[model samples]
Target: MLCIKKPSVASSFEELIPKILTEGDLVETEFGERTKEIRNTIIEITNPKLKKVPEKYPLGEKAVEEYRKNLLYGSKNIFSYDYHERLFEYPYNEERINQIDYIIEKLNQQKNSRRAIAITWNPKIDIEVSKDERGSVPCLQFIEFLVRDNNLHMTVVFRSNDALLAYVANALGLISLGEYIAEKTNTQLKSYVHHSVSMHVYIDRDRDYIKKYFPEYLKYIE
Candidate 1:
């Protein structure tokens, strides 16, 4: 378990990656490279607005609907009760089954409830680990919101996080959620506690991915 306490002057969350990835435990997956799992890493960010964004995400002012569907909200298409008889399963529904609505409504109603939560993984679709045809399973598992001292704090859990591609993007999405909930519940954004069970940068047999992508991985390593 990695419990890293960053100083207030530490900048972006990405800057703190090398500290864990370079010193964590290694485990081989059926996927490409051996992943470095920090297991249970709880790193604190001084600012809720984590100021790091990757080139690939490229969310212009966070208006990308596609990213929203994948991150905070699940697909709008969902199965109805009659899904068994229909040939075209996974039908469309008007309401999103994600936790954003629950968060907003419950937190607005009762700020002290400990159940303002959001879940991303659906076990019916996510059970197949070997099936690449299932678009992509969610890397983030769950996020819970708590209010302490009139401040809304978020705790994010990730099953596996790509330190290069997904770390900051996921945090940004959560920050958006936190801010939205905070505004609705009349609270201030306090802290973002991220616990990634497996945070890694993928590398090929020749270490080409990181060599090409993370040229300055050690840039903020202190």
Candidate 2:
């Protein structure tokens, strides 16, 4: 596993971009050729409060805010499988479960609880649909909230993540979610850990941009 520890999201993003571009292995996907890919990448943000968006990142504050809102709230039009819907209104056995509420209540009842987890991949729906038919499936798979020493820490797992295009915004949205949870649970927000099974950059799409902005790191790539 590749591990990256950073104090803030912006720093992590800065470090990760070059690492992925230089060290990632060439892989082919349904979309196209990707420049780099690292399996089982783990990113640990020691301080979730320092949520500065990198200046070079394409999205601005407003866009990040919208993404966070969509993540916490619901946006059916934006995503085929919205994270909010999966978390807040999970379907199972002809019933719906509000996982977010469950996590909050669990932590409130027992701060040391390890069972407070929310899962996005519903096998009933996710396994049945074909990727070609759906166009996009949920990349985020699991989320867990833990309260230790009066601080709330969040960990999320993704089956696949776009390291260059989507990681920064995704981290911001998750940090917002963690803050919301911390507020509800009355715990100070602390670390944010992100794990990705496949963290990749779309080379065919962003090669020029990488060459233009990160020319120095190109030496690491073959």
List the candidates' TM-scores in order.
0.71, 0.92
| C-alpha local distance difference test of each model | 0.59, 0.85
**Collision pairs in model 1:** none
List, in order, the clash count of every candidate structure: 0, 1
Off by over 4 Å in 2: 76-78, 131-134, 218-222
Where does candidate 2 clash, by residue pair? 35-203
User: Tens digits of per-residue lDDT for model 2 on 1-222?
Assistant: 689999998999888888887778888876556558899999999999898888867556777888899988887586557888898999898998999999999999999999999999887777765346545678999999989999998999999998877888899998999998899999988899999999988776876666776778666654
Cα deviation at 1, candidate 2, in Å, is 2.6
In the range 94-185, model 1's lDDT, one tens digit per residue, is 43353566677888788788998766555555566327643466676777888878888888888888665556656666676677778878
